[model samples]
Target: MNFINGPCGYFNMIVITSRSSSIPIVFRRQLSALTTLPLTLSQTNKNGQKHDPPSKINSPPPLGRLRASVVSPESTHFVDSYLTHSFFSDELKISAKNGFLSRGRQLHAHIVKLGYYNVLALQNQLLHVYVKCKVYYDACRLFDEMLVRNVVTWNTLICGAAHCGRSFKSNLNLGFCYFKRMLSEMVGPDCVTFTSLLHTCIELYDIEIGRQVHCFIMKFGLCRDCFVSSALVDLYAKFGLVGDARRIFDNILDRDLVSWNVMVYCYALNCLVRDAFGLFNLMRLEGIKEDDFTCTNLLNSAAIYGSCELGRQIHGLVIKLSFDLDVAVSSALVDMYAKNELIVDARKTFDGMLSRNVISWTTMIVGYGRVGDGKEAIKLIREMFRGDTGPDELTLASVLRSCGNSSSITEISQVHAYAMKDGFDAILSTANSLINAYSKSGNITMALDCFSSIANPDLVSWTSMIGAYAFNGLSIEGIELFERMLAYNMMPDPVAFLGVLSACSHGGLVYEGLHYFSLMTKIYHITPTIEHYTCLIDLLGRAGLLDEAFNLLTSMPVEPGPDVLGAFIGACKVHGNAGLAKWAAEKLFALEPSNPVNYTLMSNIYASEGCWLDVARIRKMMRDRCIYKVPGCSWTEIAGEVHTFVSSDKSHPRASEVYALSELLVRSMEEEDYVPNEDFTFDHV
Candidate 1:
């Protein structure tokens, strides 16, 4: 008789099947090892039957050149246990890699008996075993029982906790507590401790804690430590601090590719696209061979900058290096093309991917979602499932996102049900997507239900709930929700503050928006991004506080971009504040002398006040510069076909029928005294 105890360490558990004459679809362990209590390996078979000779397996060579104080006979004995432990650990890791989990567990039990009962070493290795085998409860139980707890012990358990997918906060806290205790014990942290903490902080977005760690390193004069230093650069980059991260990168004397990649990747993330290009060029001059990761980051930067020229150059580089088939690199290429608004090019890139993974599928779904191709996004999700892969939160979130913009409440609800069924409804992202979808679909009850149920809601979740309330005309509720968010220990992020500020602007809470804007940098430490400025400008402008809004635009520490300038000019036009309108117009016209919208926005201000001559002058200037609005196009997809209609497009299949229908609709609207909002029309047209 034979039995499999399975990966969970329970014995004699019924697997509910027998008839062993045929080859077992799931094989059980046939061998094991015996232990010599004082910490040594003696191999055997599962039924206590001896098999492999324990003495035949050679121990790993002794640690060479390690500090002498930490090495001795006892250490050699410990190292022996570590080696046997490593053997079992390697087996478990291999099993997980090959999806043969039960076999790995049997091997683990065999190794355990071979002199590795030290709570410290065993706890560490057992934590790793449970993590690799993905048995979270067992891992936590082992972590709890350990008499000795060091940073590594805490790190292994914390990392294991995070790996299980949803219990990050518990592990995140454990990592922090262990680190703090280690420091209090004067254990003197190394690079690994800082890296692990920074990783959790990045997830937590605990900037205050991250900065505290940064300050501690600086105080200890360990900022020059390569690993800790590299992690700091990465952390700063994550929180939108590219300049500082770059400065740190430049200061590192013994930097590696990881260090350089951290800075370059962060550079791309902050839309410092040209800087990313410059850094890449500098790396080339330094003779640092661009690896697949380098090319991937370069592609991501290129995509975000919307520079087709750079993207094509990188495409050539990938082909030159024959690295185009690399999945990570290919995924970045796909993401870049999609973000650049080149769906055809993105499709070409996707089709060229010889090996596709979840990242590849998710990127394409996001591309389709961005362009409002709901059915395509849904079809892609189905395709991924058909291949026997489960949809992760990212997959469901992307599809739910498409439904959000399409106003497809029914589809969103179905996706919501599926997400709940797949155990993703508890994840913040999937829950946030569900909230957004329900809100956009006008199911406020359902939207609020998802929001209220999210325990320990992050900034994104809080912001989503507030935004939903504000979007649906419940401004008071939105403001109150934001206040509640502030009451929590968690600090609101820039995006969250922006939502609340916009709510205040809508609700005529001028004093409140102004207060929050000031507190944003000083207290919360979120530097005022351009969007934040735009929100403030709009807030002031809406209140007919044109002068104040104008002052904000001019006095901005950062140079105002076209969007910022346009918002100010639009507000000036509304308030009939010609002084600022003229001020904004000059900047707008010079921004792109050939931009049709700028010319039109200004001309409308003139035409609205019965200034026909000015409108004509603007039109003549447009013609002179060869500037015209791109033809007005409206596209609706039906049955997977995109049907595009222009205001007077005669080239479509149903052009005549559409024209007749428009005429009839216009007549009906005229009878009801409905005035067409001519905002879509250009005077020149």
Candidate 2:
């Protein structure tokens, strides 16, 4: 039989399958050598026939690379084995590139059957294919079987362990241990090895390990490498060490685009808007082109500073560079306009986009919500559902916030149902938003149910539930839950303590409130903010301890803000403490001269004590200052639409019908002998 129909079917398989026209000329010549050579087999075939080997077989002339290994007496056979091994290695690389694990395994099986399994080069190639396909366990097994390994062998496993998409800590530890083994084996690392390890440190937020890696790079003089220095910059930037990051970035002898982007991102991450803008100007002077990432950071910085004019300039630059079509840059533009309260401009950009991701849709939805346009926000959400991209957890949370602001109970319920169907309810942010939405919709029971659904309630979870109870006036339940959270070893944060203190203030738990305050300050070492002091003062004043409340206010380290004084004034009105009420009202008036609520509360306090002259004086002061109490606005959702009503507003379409219904409710209240407090009317004085 000819070699094409040879007894060794494995060589024929390799020649037929991998002999593509696109393969290089050198490989094609080697493949031709395999088929044209007259082969002989020493082993017996399945038919129990042993073929005789040729004694004077000549080596192929084009196989000079592997010709050095042909020094053995069986030169032709050895050349065949080397050529086959080389072809298999190249094919394995292609398999790895395409992530074809099955094809890779078949090639591996062929290698083992041909008795080339112990070849170091072939084993390393197989290990690489497994790692590329993410079959890490099989890669580890193959690695353990190899008796001899090179630096490539150790580097493959190290990089694979770092990026296997497992637990962050576990992956970092695994990569670190592999590096230790590599060092113990006297295998020095290259630039690629250190770069991967630094990336793992960045992911794990282990800055200490990153520092150690930096030391190693310095010692090995690899700090001059572009990629290694860029990684070090990213590592320091993530930890907010801007000075260190800049030092490394400046030391880079050959600064590439990635190095410049890292430094710009570091400034942006730290909110140094002027510094970031300055660098962008320098980069433009250097004539280095900016990509979508660079523009996105600059847009974010402008949005944070509320520099709408600067954002417009950047928007012009985006169009000039044709980056306006990029989804990330377009999304940043929309966010900039939305945050500056230019909703119309934001809408124009959203409408002009050719394609959009979930972030694009969510940014537009949140923009409408920010401007109190919940109808438009809800409409976009429906349109998003009809498209290819659906809402993520953040999208759901933003819509939930809009619904809560409008008190749209029906919409909140619909979203909660959708969350359950789409498996987003388990996300902590979505779950917390659900709790707050239900609480704001006046459905405390539903909020409690949502809170109980969390499998692992984090700190935000417990705090949301506590605030829900406080908002609904279920203070006892809120306190019990707070205690339960403490029992579960969930350390209460400042916001958590604020929630429980508000609960105590509403429920009149003076002793418990003082104890918790002491616990927060003494045991937890949390400094009390103005809100905490306000809650404590309100709690004391409500129980008729006006002097004690004033004492605490005076003893506070920080000056009292408007909210603190307002709460104290409300408590004073409840207890008829006009003397202390006047002192606080004067301080509040000085602090906020334009706020009409402070003057109203002070006038009401005087009217209740029957001091008509003082009330008239306060009214005259308001009139002279052109101060008018802003009308309170309330909204109710009806049939999936929100209707807003200001106090005594006559602009509603059905104003006559609303007035008639209001009169009917008032007459019924009168029939039941309900009394109205005349002193409360002085708030409108």
Candidate 3:
């Protein structure tokens, strides 16, 4: 098609003079061989009648397409000739569709083969192209080839290094060196240059350098610049300076949506859910339009809050805004709702998705698991495998955790086999999850076996396996794991110490627990956390060392937190130490006034001691405080539906049938003189 300016010659074409502007003269000669039709044209009708060309059409007067033609990949000569221009580079822009990288790379290779040497521009683009291809070596070679490198040249190298995950010390230094040179040589770095530099700083955890960069930009009057402002927000956010990041973001002269989203994401990632939501509300009040990224951030924040109500509200807004169809946003919504135990909402969202990625499928599966739908979790995995999608390390790990509840050792092994085949067995998170799964599944040995297979376990991995042993009632094994961890010279974090202390508590190894507790502080300088104290109380309580437990709580340097107080109260209950239990209850109530569990535990303690008046008083306190014990519910997924079972709730779809069967089973057990264990489980009457 011949494309030209309008008759008035007042319009410029969007990009090309014609779609075939990149075609060169020599490339057109070969097209004649492909088709038998002679090159020809038709005349346009002007005003009334069609005008005839003089027997023949004059040759086109341009270097573009001489004749219409089709070329295949095998026609290397044609491709080389055709690619000697900047056509595909423009199309690689963000406005183009998803496969720009693929098409752009093919054209780039062809362009290089044509040997049209503009050494400077070519070297600059070559560095970027090689980086895009993840060919870091070639990128470096091309970067070094430039006799006179410009600012773009240096920025390209740094960006390429950062993009390719070449966090190698030298590469990281070179990126910084280039940034420094830009300042020293006075190349006048732009917004892109500073943002890239900040990313490198964050990756390297050079918070000091990041701060300096921020100040530098501010002094130069670039603080109001959106790109600089956003980069600073992200950098400070990453380094745990949420307040500073938020301040910089707030001070931006013109806060665009991207700026808002970046700041909001920073808040959410730092676990400041309230602040995130508050900022989101601010955005809405300011009449800022929310997009998929915005929805994703808000929903993700709500999910982290573990607030079902808030998550549902965001999900509703997404539907209202028609952003529910966005795969990333919808997947985030699913995760949020799932974690909130709104399985129905999560499943509905997942089902409504027009397309789903592996992350989407896995998020739903994890949501099911969080709601205790182990069967549904496994079912989803099976379905994913049956369909086109397959499980990643995270999916495998989550499903293994689902199997933990059933103690499905056989199924766990099967998953392990699958992991081995898919080469996902090497990921650290997967390994840790598998260890926890095995431990919970009543195979402490297998859990240990799994831990041993991780060639080198980080602190988290080691702590996980050690905690696994302690969790599964094998305190001796847990202690041994801790000892082994110490032998490897892996500095145990506070969590690791808690696991070891709890192990000692379980094994009645009071002396060992005390020794490690001391070593944890004196040798490792690790401060004892509330959880560590809880483990000590549990240890002493379980071993009937009631007075020592009371003494431990009283001797704490700081005021006891809820978990610590709760632990002491639980121990007092176990040992029938009424006075200590009363003190523990009072501390717990004062610390966590809204905790129904504390009130209920106090009432139960009074009831056990047959103190009727005290029980009455406890109940009165509960009533005055408006505290009521929420009935616990458990859900299991089967046949694509989550079956929720709750005490005193007759709303399960199979409630009538399940209740009748439960009654029958209870009757049979009663006839056999079986007594219900009301102490451990409050769910059943």
Best by lDDT: 2
**TM-scores for every candidate against the unseen true structure:** 0.66, 0.78, 0.72
**Residue lDDT tens for model 2, 440-509:** 8899999999999999999999999999999888999999999999999998999999999999998899
Rank ordering of all candidates by TM-score, starting from the highest = 2, 3, 1
lDDT of each prediction vs. the true structure?
0.74, 0.82, 0.73
Model 3 C-alpha lDDT per residue in residues 1-685, reported as the tens digit of each score: 2322222221111212223444312233233332111323223332222233345423322212412333443552222211222333333332123433455455445434433223355556656766666566766776665566677877887775555454365666667776776678777777777788788787777899888778778777888999889888989888889989988987998999999999899988988989888999999899998789988988888888887787878878988988877889889988888878889988988998998999999999888777666777877887898888888988998888887765566667778888888888888888888898888767788887888899979998989987887787788888888888889988888889988898898788988998999999999898887788888878888788988887888898777888888777777776678898997788788877876777788888877788979988877787788546676667654543445676777887767888899899989998999987655432121
Q: Which model is ahead, 2 or 3, in terms of TM-score?
A: 2
For candidate 1, give the lDDT: 0.74
Better of 1 and 2 by TM-score: 2
Give the number of the best model, judged by TM-score. Answer: 2
Query: What is candidate 3's CA lDDT for residue 176?
Result: 74
The Cα RMSD of model 1 versus the native structure comes to 11.4
After superposing candidate 2, which stretches have Cα over 4 Å from the reference?
A: 1-167, 586-594, 606-630, 678-682
lDDT tens readout by residue for model 1, 153-266: 766755554344334466556667766667787767766666777777887778899888788788777888778888899899999987789788888889788877878889
Q: After TM-score superposition, what is the CA distance of residue 15 in candidate 3 from its true location, in Å?
A: 31
User: What's the true lDDT of residue 660 in model 1?
Assistant: 96
